[model samples]
Target: MTDPSPTNFAAPWEAQVFALVVSLREAGLFTWSEWADRLGRQIRPADGPERTADYGAWLTTLEAILAERGVAGPESVAARTEAFLRAAEATPHGQPIRLENDPLYRP
Candidate 1:
């Protein structure tokens, strides 16, 4: 049976993550088969069974692969993530969130 319900990304970040994976693949960072294998392992770790459509796992897998390929270090990603979090928190409701909005952000 197939789901009759319309399927779409629940949030903008989900779409962004999907696009990022596609863009990376298109750029030859990794083959589609490699991506599927890594994503499968990520969703179904040795400690558990396959999870259903978890985009968080997708993001994690992307991060891991990027780090492995030396595209982005974990420290840089973490710092950027933290900066975004701070900026999001500092931004007023209905305003766009920018890294510059972060209180600790300089230049």
Candidate 2:
């Protein structure tokens, strides 16, 4: 599914999920179905609990996968995470204001 955010990147949490999937698959840590099942179970109703899906857990899983694959490290994951955060912060608040285009409408 496509995210509606202005940026063409996944949200921070979504990125983590994607990374997890990739890391696991590359290392043969878990089958796609197994990973999906585990992640689905992690998500819960927002107001349900103080502790929910932990991003750290996902990172740890990724690290384990990398280790299993004998890969160098998570340099790429860190870079992607920084980029996603920058994009999120750069997004503007509320609707874009066009004074000449909407002269009749006043904020």
Candidate 3:
């Protein structure tokens, strides 16, 4: 039987994150049940805002799981995020951003 869940993404990054999660799961990084449990907690924290279909939460959960699994620690993730931001800032309009574009890029 075919699944009927909505597959629409509001942004390209959302689709990318979704694909990353699926790839990681397929690679045995984590199970769907574990992902769902963590994602549920992230989406419905007692003091947090109620969220539904929040791709941002998916990203956050992915990061957390990766860190928990020693796949990529927070420091590395933060550094990469900074590098991407710098690269984006250095990129000219209508140009694709690349990490090599970052002023501090080495090699």
**Each prediction's Cα lDDT score?**
0.92, 0.56, 0.92
In order of appearance, the predictions have TM-scores of 0.87, 0.35, 0.87
Q: In model 2, what is the error at residue 16, expressed in angstroms?
A: 6.8
Per-residue lDDT of 1-107 in model 2, one digit per residue for the tens?
47665663346766766665776577776787766555454454366653344565455555555655666367766655565555555545573433323323234
> What order do candidates take by lDDT, descending?
3, 1, 2
User: With candidate 1 superimposed using the best TM-score fit, by how many Å does residue 104's alpha carbon deviate from the native?
Assistant: 0.9
The runs of at least 3 residues in candidate 1 whose Cα sits more than 4 Å from the true structure, single-residue gaps closed, are: 1-6
- Residue-pair clashes per prediction, in order, are 0, 0, 0
Candidate 3: give the clashing pairs. none
lDDT digits (tens) for residues 1-107 of candidate 1: 37897566889899899999999999999999999899988888788777864788889999999999999989999999999999999999999999999999999
Clashes of 2: 0
TM-score ranking, best first = 3, 1, 2
Q: Give the per-residue lDDT digits (tens) of candidate 3, residues 4-106.
A: 9865898999999999999999999989999999998888879878788488999999999999989999999999999999999999999999999999999
Pairs that clash in candidate 2 = none
Residue 97 error, candidate 1, Å:
0.3
